[model samples]
Target: MLLINCPFCGAREEHEFHYGGQAHITRPADPEQVDDKAWADYLYYRKNTLGLQAERWQHSFGCGQWFNALRCSQTHQFKAVYKMGDDAPEGLQ
Candidate 1:
């Protein structure tokens, strides 16, 4: 099993956490003004990178706060975990 390091609870099993998708993604303010293409991009589009990826994760069984994680998509290995407002590493973006 993959061990995910929780920002609050340290390292733990992956099942304890829930994936919250890509981080820093914000919804459009004007829904009606947004065209179908923009709507589809926001709803269905995602960056499926192979290397390190910045993703949002929730510590459901612990503090229950949303945090950002720098993880490797290919290996499912987490390199770092930080709170929502915390600054991400230089290579993340």
Candidate 2:
């Protein structure tokens, strides 16, 4: 079984967590000013990478906290796990 490290709860089985999709996506500063296409893009589009990607995850069955992880999309290896709102480790970007 796959193991995922929760920043607050240590390592746990992957089934105890939930994938929250790509991380670091920014919302429009002024939603009313954004065009329809831009709004749609923000809601529907995400970067799909084959290498290291920053993603959001929730430790649903553990700490019940959200965190970010730098993981390899192709290999599913997690390089680092960090708390929400904290900066990712240097050079992991």
Model 2, C-alpha of 29: deviation from truth (Å): 1.4
Candidate maximizing lDDT: 2
- TM-score for candidate 1, please give it: 0.80
Per-residue accuracy of model 2 over 40-70 as CA lDDT, tens digit each = 9999999999999999999998889999999
| Model 1 clashing residue pairs (backbone) | none
User: Whose TM-score is greatest here?
Assistant: 2
TM-score of each: 0.80, 0.93
Error of 2 at 42 (Å): 1.0
What would the per-residue lDDT of candidate 1 be over residues 1-93, giving only the tens digit for each residue? 988888777888888899999886778999899999999998999998888889999989777878999988988888889889877887655
Q: After superposition, how far is residue 84 of candidate 1 from its true place, in Å?
A: 1.7
* Stretches of model 1 off by over 4 angstroms after superposition: none
What C-alpha lDDT values do all the predictions have?
0.87, 0.93
Residue 8 displacement in candidate 2 (angstroms): 0.4
